[model samples]
Each structure stands twice: as C-alpha cells, then as structure tokens.
Target: MKSTRDTHRFSATTSRFLLPTFRRPCYLDIIKTNVPKSLNKSNIFHKWTEEGQAPYYTIINDALLSDNYNILNQNMIYINNLREAIKENLHQDSIKVYRNLKFCSTYVKDEYKEGMTFLWPTFSSTSRNKDVASTFGNYTFEINASTNDFTYRTDISMYSKYSYEQEVLFYPYSGFRVKKIIPDARIIQLECVDTIEVESNSRILVPEQVKIFDAERKMFVYFYKDNEDLHWSHADTPDQMYLIGQNMNGYWDSHYRYHHSNGYFVHKGNNLWEEYQNEQFHASFQQI
Candidate 1:
C-alpha cells in the first residue's frame, strides 16, 4: 500500500491570439490601445521629460525614407545593416515586432577574418526652388558616402528660406507636423520611409538636431543653437538639443507643419536615434 497516487499538471503557457466576435475594416487597428499603461504612449516620453529643456525642437527626430519597402525586401542595403545593428545592441533573445515598423531580418557576415568599422556617409536632402512640393515633404537627397558628410539640399541650393509663390511649400496638418529633421552631426543616410500615420497624442515627432565628434575640428560645428541652449562643446556621443518655436507653421519652428486637413501623409520619420554612438539603432527601441 505505498499505493498509487495520480497527479496532473496543466500549463497555461500556450500562446494565444486576439480573437474577436466580429472583425471590421482594420479591426486590429485600434488594438494599439491595449498596450500596457506602462509601455503605453504616456510613459513613452520618459527621455523627453528627463532632458533639461524642451526647446522648439522638442519634437522627436524621425528620418523617413521615401521608400521603406526596400527594407521589407532586404534589398535596402543600408537598412539591412541597420537592422543588424539593432539586433546586436538589444542582445535580444529575438526581435519581436508588434506594431508599426515591423522587425525584419538582419544581415550578418559569416567571415570573421577581421572586424569591420562601418561608416555611413552623410549627404544632404533639401527642397528644390524653395517650394513645398519638392523640398518640404520629400527630399531629393544626394548620397555622399565617399565624404561621410551630408547637408540639407536647400543648404546647397541658391534659396535657403521658405517661399510660397515660387516653391509650393506644402504646409498642411493639425496641431503640428515636423517640417524639418536635421542631423546634429555628419552621418550616413541609413534608412528612410515615405509615410507612417500615427494617431497617438501620447507620442509625437520632433526635430532633434544631433552632432558627433570630429578630430580635425575640435568643435563639431562652428556654431549651433537649440531652443534651450546656445552652444554645445562635448563630443562623447551625439548631443540631442532643441530650439523650440520656429517652423513652417504652428508652435514648432519654421519647418514644422501644423496639420494637413488633406489626410495624405507627408514624409515623417518616426522619432529615432540617427546613430548609436557612431553605430545605428532602431527607433522604437531607442529613446529621444
């Protein structure tokens, strides 16, 4: 009679999917609402609040590419490299994409004969003829990898200011839409996308200017100004500072658009870290 005893254990580890009684057009669309209150939009701006000041450029810096599909296809050479960088940094057990900007595969080299120092060349993308159409939303960018420096297309163009008559400068939206996203330092144009519609008051995009270190010139840029401070000298990593209230229209700056009644999205690269200390980082995973 050490007799037999029956025991059973049930596990709830099985993965489950959200099943709905009825599905509607883009039913899963609003599901973004269920994201935990912690990871939700409100607390997402943690980096912003921690910062010293919210300059006019309080908006996050998001660099959108005219063609993000290239990334989905892996044909986007630069982005593929960027994806790898993201995977490496997070030390992620696995990359999990839950929402906008899905996580795609990364490109890795097998040969370890030697290490590689990857560098993205910097180039400027600007508007042509000072109009909104050509330069405002979509940029006709010039990739200058050989030099590793990029400038705004308008910077090279004859006209630098915003003009309506000659250059149909497009200004359309509500509250505010980022009109310009400038890199604080010289960096290679890694990846950009055409349009991403985000309807989250908890989160917003801003113009974050960042600069890197240059040995040749002790100071990265001769002169720099943000909404908060006047000058920056440190060169350890990229410094993200903003000078608020100067935009195409609305509260931001001379480049930001308020809100386009037309619903068609212009190019807005969701806030991101252009380079992770000379490396690259994914947007959602990184901070302001």
Candidate 2:
C-alpha cells in the first residue's frame, strides 16, 4: 500500500476496462458504483470480495509488478480490499503449495540457478495439490510457506470460482529462497523467507562510494545505487538513515548498520547482512 502519489492514470486498455457499464455491470462495475459509500469509508466491505475469475485480479497483479507508481495507485483500492480479505481468511498453520511454469530453455538456465533467491513482486497463485500444479507445466515449484505477521498468505480456494483448484495466494513482494533443484524431475524446492521491510513513500538512498572487503573471497565487493529500496532493514530506523547498494550479482549486499558506541558503522545482528555473509561463506563448499 506504499505509494508516492495520490492520483493515478491507468493505461488506455485498463482505463477502458474500468469504465462503468449501464447495461449489465461486471464485478468491477458493481464495486465502482454499487458498493456502499459508507463501506468505502470504513474499508470493511472488502471481506465480501471474491477472487473468482475476475478480470480485476489481472489488472491488480499487473499494477503490482509495474515500475510506475501511478499504475499501482490506480489499483490501490482494489489491492487493499483484496489484501484485507486475504488477511481475514489466512490459515492458522504452515502449508505447502505448488506452482508450475513453462519457461524458455535459456531463461530457466539463466534465472533458476540453485541457491538464488526469487521474489514474486506480484500476487501469485499456487495450488494445494501437487497434481493440479503439474498439469500446468513441466517445471514445478514446491514451496513451503506459512502465515505470520510478516508473511502474508492465505487459502483463497473458498473465494475462487475454481474451488477445486484449492488455490493458495501469496501477497505481492513475497520472497522465497531456492533450496534445491532436481533437473531430472524439473522440480525446484523453495522456502519462504522474509527479506526487507517495505514502507510507503520510501526510496533507496545510496552513499556516493562504499566498498567492503571480503576476506574469504580475497576481493572487494563494490556497491551501486538502486532506483527503489526493496532490501529490508529495521522499521524504527529512519528511511534516510538506511542505504542499499547492489553487489556484482545485482543482489542487495549492503549492510544495514547503525552508529556504534565506538564511532563506527557496525552491521546489525540478525539481519540481511548475516544471511548474506552466511550464504556467501557456505557457497564455496560443494555438497558431497
């Protein structure tokens, strides 16, 4: 729900789709017109919203992935409604989900590397049944996920038109660490992991020049600025106080540090720096 602007201009195609209809109102039309004004103020009517084969989901998901803040703002209302609905119906325990995707051979080879972290920036749909997932494609993703305060996911099968699919929805910007890859079986195992805290009106701030020495690698890791701040840091820390820089792999490797008592910027314990360091140190060893 974090956005820079209040107003948004939709694409021509999306604008046309969102127009009110007088003859027979579609789901979105009803939402734009008939949904009570009081409910809009209260922001409580979203609980009644269903996730069936509505065209709005496509728009919402697309907007979530877009770089344009205006596009996302345009769909903010729908997105908030869906998020509230999902939160209201979230499962109490951990669950496993599956998704199948068809990728170009080159893309799979380049992007699905083992030990890499994959982020779903848009609302993603998965299935509770592995069989249903397999029917979609040959490349299967086996995800272990849970619902918690930081992690947002829900079993939306009850609200979906295709209830038999047993759909599980992961909210936008969910992070998953790739654990294993079985090339023969075309299965990729992933575990849900928390990355960075996302806040509204926040943008990445990078230092002009900063480099860290990797004693293990025997080389210096260079840093570059990013347009957006996706890496997680302490919520209490002011946005301007935190900085993010990408390493050679285009991954966030900058340390989230605070001023120490000794007048040094020291990395915070139990944060992204710890995970990155651990991963880097262990990456050189081959699994026997």
lDDT of each: 0.20, 0.46
Against the correct fold, how does model 2 do in TM-score?
0.52
The candidate that wins on lDDT is 2
TM-score of every prediction relative to native:
0.15, 0.52
- Residue 117 of model 2 has an lDDT of 52
* Per-residue lDDT over 35-66 for candidate 2, one digit per residue giving the tens place of the 0 to 100 score: 21232312332222233344555566555443
- Where model 1 places Cα greater than 4 Å from the true spot, the runs are 1-171, 174-211, 220-226, 234-288
Worst 10 residues of 2 by lDDT: 16-25
* Candidate 1 least-lDDT 10 residues: 7-16
Overall local distance difference test of candidate 1: 0.20
Model 1: per-residue Cα lDDT over 1-288, one tens digit each: 010111000000110011011111121222222322232222222221222343111211111111112222332233223222222322212111100111112211111012111111111121222222222222221222111122111121122122221210110111112223223321112221111221222114333532333343333321112333223343443364333332221121112111111111111235221212112221121122
